[model samples]
Target: MIRKVVILSMLLLILILFMLTIEDININTSARDYLFENGFRETGSNNLVTAIYLDYRLYDSIYEAGILLVTVSGIIFMSKKDDDVL
Candidate 1:
């Protein structure tokens, strides 16, 4: 009985959060406009997409790459047979 209640409560909480996020979708437009107007000047890149990705979100990209490398390494390690080890 308690487990069902907890699951229902969690579902309701998630629903509320999703509704709140949907209401604020327009807020991102201002940032998009600012980037479109000043991205080149601030980042000194001719390509807008490149400027945004390489300058504004450089740390995010680097962390994502690191995460991918670690995930791939872990998968490779886990897939290896024990007999392969010396």
Candidate 2:
């Protein structure tokens, strides 16, 4: 009964918080323009977002690739069984 009440309270709080967040937030157009002016000619990428993601955030991309590789390795490891275990 206590657990159910706690869970219900948490759900209610989450619902209230979700409702409080305003969706229609204004974005800074100047920031976009600044990135475009600096990034396009400097990075040689046509898209500013792509240039930032590929170059400025290359380490993040590498880490993401590593995570993907680790996940694949985990899946492969789980799929394979040793003959000794069988």
Candidate 3:
């Protein structure tokens, strides 16, 4: 009974908090402004996220692809059958 009451109160509190919170999505944050100001000049990319991942951290992207390739290869090797050994 006490647990149920506690859970109910906590959920009510969360609901009230969310209801009173701001709902603005077009908030021009500082990070967005900074990225907009420097993304093109620093990385020569029109898309900010693409500029970050492809231009600024090309090695990281390459390494992640390599890891994915290795993982797929391992999965394929493990999933293959030895039917010829019969």
Candidate 4:
């Protein structure tokens, strides 16, 4: 009984999320125009997405780099063997 209730609750939550995601709303139409008007030309990048990813949110990029570094380190650590195995 509890399992059925949990499954039904999960299904209902997923259905609500799907419905919410399907509703499209226009929130910011002038965001691009604003960025262009302000002087992205000085940044020396033609693509707005690249400019934003590399410069506007560099801290997030740093965090992403840290994640990659940690992932690589974990992979290397897990792949290593003891002296007897080596």
TM-score for each predicted model, relative to the true structure: 0.58, 0.60, 0.55, 0.59
lDDT for model 1:
0.89
In candidate 3, list every pair of residues with a backbone clash.
Answer: none
State the lDDT of candidate 1 residue by residue for 1-86, as single tens digits.
99999999999999999999999887658888998899988999989888977998999889989999999888888989997732
Better of 3 and 4 by lDDT: 3
25-78: candidate 4 lDDT, tens digit per residue: 556758678768654775667887778778888889899999999998888777
Q: Ten-residue segment with the worst summed lDDT in candidate 4?
A: 77-86
Pairs with backbone N, CA or C atoms under 3 Å apart (clashes), candidate 2: none
Candidate maximizing lDDT: 1
Write the residue-wise lDDT of candidate 3 on 1-86 in tens digits: 99999999999999888776756345669977888899999988888889988987799999999999999888887887877321
> Which clashing pairs does model 4 show?
none
Q: By summed lDDT, which 10 consecutive residues of candidate 3 come out lowest? A: 19-28
lDDT of 2 at 32: 74
lDDT winner, 1 or 4: 1
Candidate 1: residue pairs that collide: none
**Candidate numbers sorted by lDDT from highest down:** 1, 3, 2, 4
lDDT of 2 by residue, 1-86 (tens): 99999999999999888767745555569967878689977799998778988998899989999999999888877887875231
Model 2 ranges off by over 4 Å: 1-26, 84-86
Query: Which 10 successive residues of model 2 have the least lDDT summed?
Result: 19-28
Residue 28 deviation, candidate 2, in Å?
3.8
